[model samples]
Target: MSQNREMKLAAYLVGTGIHVASWRHPSAKPNTSIDIEALQHLAQTAERGKFDLAFIADSLAINPESHPQILNRFDPVVLITALSAVTRKIGVGATASTTYSEPYILARQFASVDHISGGRAAWNVVTTADATGETALNFSRDKHWEHDHRYERAEEFIDVVQGLWDSWEDDAFTYNKQTGQFFNPDKLHELNFKGKYFSVKGPLNIARSKQGQPVIIQAGASLPGQRLAARTAEVVFVHWDNIKEAKHHYKKLKSQLKDFGRNEDELHILHGISPIIGETEEAAIQKYNDLQNLIDPYEALKFVSGYMGNVDFSKYSLDTPAREIEFPHVNSIQSNFNEMKKIVEKEDLKVGDLYTRFFGAARRDGFIGTPVQIADELEKWFTEKAADGFMIQFPLLPNDLEDFVRLVIPILQERKLFRLDYEGNTLREHLNLKKPKNVFIQKTGASKSYSKI
Candidate 1:
């Protein structure tokens, strides 16, 4: 069998902020998180480093239980769209929840971004699993949709979104100045889609994007989540703290794709990772320790407890073993909790030590070492089939990212493991993906029964 090519890389940014305490960092700017100029600089730096894409994560509702550190920021779609205007080459991707958004509106927004970015746009498809606060705020109801029901609605949502994207044919818009004709009316389509969850009518008002459609990315790890990804996602984001577990997940996800008649190469599995790079291993370790020391024990405990299914750790002693605590439920985010259990068990960590470990591992897999060492580890994961690539999350905003871009990226480029320059213009082109056909056009004028509109 032929081996896969070198892994691709992307940078993951969470709203207007990097570290939980990044705002407190002496050199950090308070307004950098939401400042357009700062974001433009960040995007340019990533492009200069030849990164594949700059990704922004989103959540519909805020967790009141969490800290109020760096959560305030701009909406992801609006922010990424603004970033697209400033950067020339970097792929601009953002998240939108299927549960909260209408398919027609989302299709227009994503396609608009793709056009504004000159074909460099992607949408991270997420089902809003926890929408209690959002429902209360938006719908005047506090109830959230059940897990299975959310996925079911998501299935229809995906269909509607894709159908809407296909509603406008490639040749639908032909501005013939001489005849004063703006569009070919015959080529226009109406998607009268009526599903169990939603009923959307008519063609999207926007033209087909430069890349035909924005790339679809998914990052759910539940059984239903994996199934959804196998069917619809082109890029799947994953998180695993251990190499062995990551490989297992990669193999399982790949195999599941085969069952759906999809090629393994069609889905790119990118693991989430954070690297603390230094001139030497000792320096990197020292930096890691320093960051760990900066964390507030009480805050770290609260974060970990929520991640572990909201188990209260307030009563537990600092030296209490994690294994002794009984968990009530293992729901959608079990993989994360399971990984925490493994770490605690492996290190024989007490509550305090585990809290510190959890703090270091939040939103990322920690990789602390010298520049060469970091590159070597990444190369191993790529070569060993552990991952196709990584979504890098920086612990501290520009500083951590600057270090990786300046130090480790060069090492990887020297080894010919990473791109020295971009190969294509659009996100699809950069990822070597073929433009998807407009499904509506394929079956148009077929039957009256099919043409409800």
Candidate 2:
């Protein structure tokens, strides 16, 4: 590996933690989900650790069985916007569904966040993960759009949003006070885009921000999802249980970059990892087991059932091996279903074990270790090309996150694998990603106004 190569990290900022039983943890403040101060502290903690970004994941629909974080939470964008104001450097990103969102409005919202945060903004584009069609009902649709169909619309949705983002060139916003003129008319261009899924006209109201444009982050691992990320994403999030699969997926995505007229350097592949760190390996094991023991079998089954294409695992004998049953066709989060299937076949996981197995990512035996050991695993992955960086989903908020920052981060920094101090001000700078040029100016040289009187 080149000495210049460095690991990028994003703190996955869920209120309690990523684990399904996190809310029940002894130290957990269950109401942290809606507590702005608590969230601000988390974001600040990530910033204090010099993380590249603080990310929040979202889903459109929720039920009685939904995880505590999902059941009651601030809208991700709005929460991030608030976090941005309190913190100065670490980037703030949130998930937004391309399926249910209007391109124009979503474009404006993120663009505004970029400006508000002085360009430390990212949009984690996702097609809604509503496997049960419950989200479709929320949107007044009788059925959820098919998987491929959602990605098809997503491709167009992203284009429209990007088009609107390019409405004004970097120099277009010239607020001349002495002169009557405000902004260069010639530099502003209207989108006037017409697509199979949407038709949007004219430029966005907001101008480009400090980083030129908000960073584009994506996390879909399906074929269509991969295609979308290859063509458009600057940062791609993925999850894998083992290094071999992670490396294979990493190489595959990087190779696809060329097919989209991009270079491997232009995009980053981030693997999602939830680390359970302790002063000693044994301490980590005990901590991991403590959280695992908190798992409510019923709630875990309910959540897993929804993810596994809404299969009602409750119908099966809890003692039944998952491999013995036939799973229905998954219409949502195909990558998740595919991964769960792999685990079911490889392990003798009974139906009762499926939920914890999936939610745990089997971390008790994997990333649960002392700081040096955890750092060693991270170094191995980064050096071996298994991942460009990691999206850390700490098992418990504040506590687990603080442990990683206080213990593991310094070791990685000492080895020159991670930055001791933030190298740049914006998210793009932190990741060493290039700020995208205004597409309108790139194609037309001089922007042509598309406004009609």
Runs in model 1 lying further than 4 Å from the true structure: 1-4, 15-19, 67-70, 130-138, 330-334, 338-347, 359-366, 443-453
Please give each candidate's TM-score.
Answer: 0.91, 0.97
User: What are the per-model C-alpha RMSD values against the true structure?
Assistant: 3.1, 2.2
Any residue pairs clashing in model 2, and if so which?
A: none
For candidate 1, list the clashing residue pairs, or say none.
16-33
Candidate with best TM-score: 2
Angstrom error of the Cα, residue 25, model 2: value is 1.5
Error of 1 at 360 (Å): 4.7
Tens digit of per-residue lDDT, candidate 2, span 98-141: 98999999999999999999889999999987678889999889
Candidate 1, residue 70: Cα displacement in angstroms equals 4.9
Residues 28-102 of candidate 1 have per-residue lDDT tens digits of 676775788887788888888888789988765656445333356778899999889988888999999887888
Clashes of 2: 0
Local distance difference test values of all predictions, in order: 0.76, 0.87
* Best-matching candidate per lDDT: 2
